[model samples]
Target chain A: MSKNQTVEQRYLPEIQRKEIDELKTTVKGASQKIIADNIARMKKADSHRPDTMKYFDDIANLFGRRQQEIEAEKQKGKKIIGYLCLFAPTELISAADAIPVRVNSGWYDTSKLGDRVVPVEVCPVIRSTIGAKMIELSPFLEQSDALISVLTCDGMTKLSEILSDQKTIWGMNVPRVKDSTQSLRFWSAEIKHMKTQIETFTGNKITRNSLKEAITTSHRATKAFRRLQELRKGNPVIMGQDAMLVNQAYSWDDKKRWTEKTEALCNELEKRVQQKDWVCSPDTPRVMLTGTPMFWPDSWKLPALVEEGNPKGIIVADEQCSGERILNDPIGVDEWSMDDMLNAISERYLMASTCPCFTSKDGNEDRINWLLNKVKEWNIQGVIYYVLRGCMLYAMEYNRVKKALDKINVPVYYLDTEYTREDVGQLKTRVEAFMELLNARIDF
Target chain B: MSTAKEFWRWHEYRHTMPNIAPVSDDIITAGVDVGSVGSKAAVMVNGQAYSWGITRTGSNSPESAKKALDLALKDTALSTRDLRYIVGTGYGRVNVPMANKAITEIACHARGANYIWGSSVRTVLDVGGQDIKAIKIDATGRVVSFLMNDKCAAGTGRGMEVFADLLQVPIEEIGAMSLKVEAEPEPVSCTCVAFAKTEAIGLLRKGWSKEKVLAAYTRAMAVRMANLINRVGLEPALVITGGQSKNVGIVSRIETLLGVKCLPTPNWRDGGLDPMVAGAFGAALLAKALYEKTQQI
Candidate 1:
């Protein structure tokens, strides 16, 4: 906060240091301080519940070690495909003998570079993605033989068009509406076309056996995450951010390794749950994060919120994506045929479409039902509808979420947010006040 | 909880205008709003406005809350104990010491604007230091819908301060001085405060007059705020409140842009209520309602 220190150094809020800087917007003093603080807090938090830390400590490598892993795979004669959206189906890319590295935009200086090419008004996620490519800051973007963009929202659609000029951008047209009976067949056809594109681009034949193995590996990771979600139901053994990191690990690292580490974490979490050892104060208020995709290492809001805020007894759970959306559903393929497996994948993804991207009459009802069930299941006290500043899809649905939560007599706090640390003070104040409101609402 | 206010006051800015001399102890309620840029406190006696104070918030929001109350209580025969209930609102609401309840500034601003501007006022635009809020309200002064620009200061008072410092014009003179420009210049077109500051310097370096630069910045503020206002679908009988209402440059440009005249905001100098204390005033009103509800129980 001194005169000489940069604005980021002065403004960056209290974040633990040991964890990866997910947003990767590095501040000098706060970054170092957070590193030290994160180590101490994670230790202190994990001390009482030894079962939780066992897997978390080991799996920490999944964050910063992405580029190195991609490089190692490239040296192993494997092609890498950097994908933007979850709908891209990494399993298919891997089936074609290409390593699917999930690429996200969060590097700080990339935005300045991006401003020259794209209007500054576009979403920061897209800005940073294009910026990363322009500056060659993203290892995944650099390493990938091709990039896949899932037409999830307006931003991704525009991003795909712009990025196609530089890279082999495959724009996968996933239908926006989810309710039509033919949409499954529609999406299944799209995925089948995507497989052909990958096979053609990588010049690798995607055999039926390879596809099955990839689905099984993906199922294991999500199944482990499902177990982790079950652990979140009672006594909250795993802090929400740590659980989110578990979900994020699926996209960044080797799938088999991610599943193994997550399963190990889940095993510890199971023990802690049985022992009734809770890291958070029993008074902790459970809050479900319902909003847009909060990309890893590029999105630090979750970690920042949970580090100090969770300690204040506010536990964040059930993120819209990169948290629950990635982990909630499984790809079905009991018969193991190519067509059958593709159908199952489409069906599971349809079931996992909790995002408002597939807006329909049932959108609010379906989402509200899921939220209501989760609130009751996890004993949630409130819901935090966190949105990226320009992410209108999630921001647009706040009223429906609030209306539903209101009926259930639960409070919902709508947070329009961004990646910068400048407004950390303001966010903290609002969150603390919300905590006070939730506490006061509790019936004694 | 902490008595750190004793020494910190020397470094902080504090002010109170048109102080009230408390005569009755009947149903006295207080509200403190510790905002990012400034803090305000209002004391209401017998469901009526009494006195209020404004101060620049330091790190200790609790002290800012207490100091705000202290200044409001100054020149009046009143103390903290005299207030029956204390309600805290705004960004640092939870940090306020001795607050019976905490509420959001959006709700408070709507209710306060309704009370000041009249029950017929359906829209409330609150431009605070670091953020801007546009609220739609019903006849009961209950919030129908609200849009708040999160974590950006480009169109708010904080942005105004940046332009003020760059042009060597006092914050108070930004509005009037901007209007004096012979011909209006195109507004700076960046939403980022930091980016817009650079854009502003570029204009000045091009030999644009200080008035011209101020004119551009003011139009930009109005343009930025107009988008936020259009979000909730502006209703007639619109009113502006909070610290930014004092800036005529932004307000008049906004009026021109909206093509609808703004409902006159409160001005203490004109013997009207201070519009800046809307959040705190509304908090006090809510405290009275809560106090009454408890009394019935």
Candidate 2:
């Protein structure tokens, strides 16, 4: 061992560390290119995109202007708390006077670096997130003072353990059964524990007023998100990818600014609806995407393929954790007391979530019910169930979702994929075939 | 046929009917299917199959599409301008230069099977060059649901070709020769084609007969196909299409595994169409319907 080496430093050699640093430089350029290409495609997708979408494009640019803003925040001695899953209560982070950033990495190249630490069979999201930390690639992940790791699924739990060695890690155990009253009490206690952890990490006392104000910030964003969802229902003036970008920016951009920008986008869409300017024809097959969450550049491929051809399909809505469901359900509080507010936050993040991670008494009936209601509300003609490879929860739940959709005569196409670009040709053929079946129904 | 040293080659050919019927007021449409390994062009006169040509796909898809169409219309009076509409199908469908619209091969195969075997055919198992698709359809030939083999290339025409090259047997003759084995051997037992190829090489080194090796390979292919067919929830009467359908070794094995006889695809010598051209044929049929719809408007 070297003279200054510790136990942790010995496991990872200096030579391997130097190699990873070199790889990090190349991955940064490739990741920026992926973001730029996707943003270019989004802008040129349809002529009806609102001008306010530029705000989302800028924030989602990865190492662009938002990265600079984050660096500036770091310079001002503000702590950045990175959260892995949606179960990490951002309200507490903001209340503790720290910036909350969701650090789920979607870049495919970064996953290769993560392969050194984790096995190849793990899901790409976990690998990419770990790899991003290993190389210090993502600005959001690099700037974080601590990471809030929610043990939502099996892959995520292991991911937290691997990441804890690099950063000060705080853990949250999500109860599996959402319908039980006992689970809520357990989760409320966990949330209280988390508040104290964040307070100690950031060295800021989270008062009742601070929590109240943070909840208000999220409520404004949720109200704008609901408005955007309502605008997508009757007529699709905004493309699905654009709407997803606005939501994805919630994880990066300042929440209050995201709220104002989304509201402005909704106002622009309202005017388009009045003028009868639609992105696609009235009869194009409206499809809903469900299953595992897809973030940023990785999510753009499917939406682009869906909206590609003449008389193309439009992604009218999605039930993914990364999409419309990101913040659509606002937390309701009867009183502003600390205990009542924590109880409300716990219930909202845990109980109301239809994530596949939670298995109630019945098998996936909650998620199925949510999907069916959204399908009817959006006039969805087809459903695309996307499962990222190695994500066992979503992959295993495909049949239950399919069986439920089958009962209503709404066809579901099961798409199993990874974060790689090699499968684009295969995915295109399957998606086009599904579109053909939907079109045949319309014509015949 | 192979010489003492050189490998036997799969020949490429094209044919059209010697006689043509007098021109009528029927609308003519065509389809071009540019696949990963093969390209086919089919011409339909008044929603009836007129002629088709199949050729090996080259490095350039648009050129291959043109060559296939040229062969289909070799001695015919109909030209590209004569057809009211042209639709493209298969993996390289969008690369067809003259295609008016691109339809997916899944839809095309179901519709083509319906036309080839009549409306009674409700399930189709199309084993293509690089993919295997099991499609379930309604009585009217519209696709109800379908499943295709992912990323892996086992149980496809390409997989069969690998065996043919390894055994030094002609691709067509491998099927009949494989059926002559005393009894079916256990399948290659590898779900991946690369691993199966290695296993086949290992079996050959152990002095297994060529016919027995062929039997084992085809059986493995059949099992892989059957798994996909079961997943798609097969309905009868079933029909098989694509180049692999001509392989009796794979076909009989699949029939036995599924316990259902696939309806016959009439031989070309018997004045019937080639099974490989099914995707193009279906696209042609859909092109006619699309043309009629436009005319109505």
Using Cα atoms with residue i matched to residue i, what is each candidate's TM-score against the true structure?
Answer: 0.69, 0.97
lDDT of 2 by residue, A215-290 (tens): 9999999999999989989877988888888877898889898899899999999999999999888888999999
Q: Taking the tens digit of each residue's C-alpha lDDT, what string does model 1 give over B1-297?
A: 864222112113233335545566489898898888789998888667887888888788899888888987886767888898888888888788789987778767777887777789998899998888887787767766666776668788877777777666777777899999888888888857799889989988999888888898788889988988996689988888988888788889989999998987665655567788888888888788878878885
Residue B283 accuracy (lDDT) in model 2: 94
lDDT of all predictions, in order shown? 0.74, 0.86
**Candidate 2 C-alpha lDDT tens digits along B218-274:** 888899999999999988898899988888988999999999999986886555887
| lDDT of residue B94 for candidate 1 | 74
lDDT, candidate 1, equals: 0.74
Estimate how well candidate 1 is docked, as a DockQ score. 0.14
- Scored against the native two-chain complex, candidate 2 gets a DockQ of 0.75
Residue B182, model 2: lDDT of 91
Interface RMSD for candidate number 2?
1.3
Residue pairs with clashing backbones, model 1: A16-A38, A17-A34, A17-A35, A17-A38, A22-A297, A22-A298, A23-A297, A23-A298
For TM-score, the strongest prediction is 2
Provide per-model DockQ scores.
0.14, 0.75
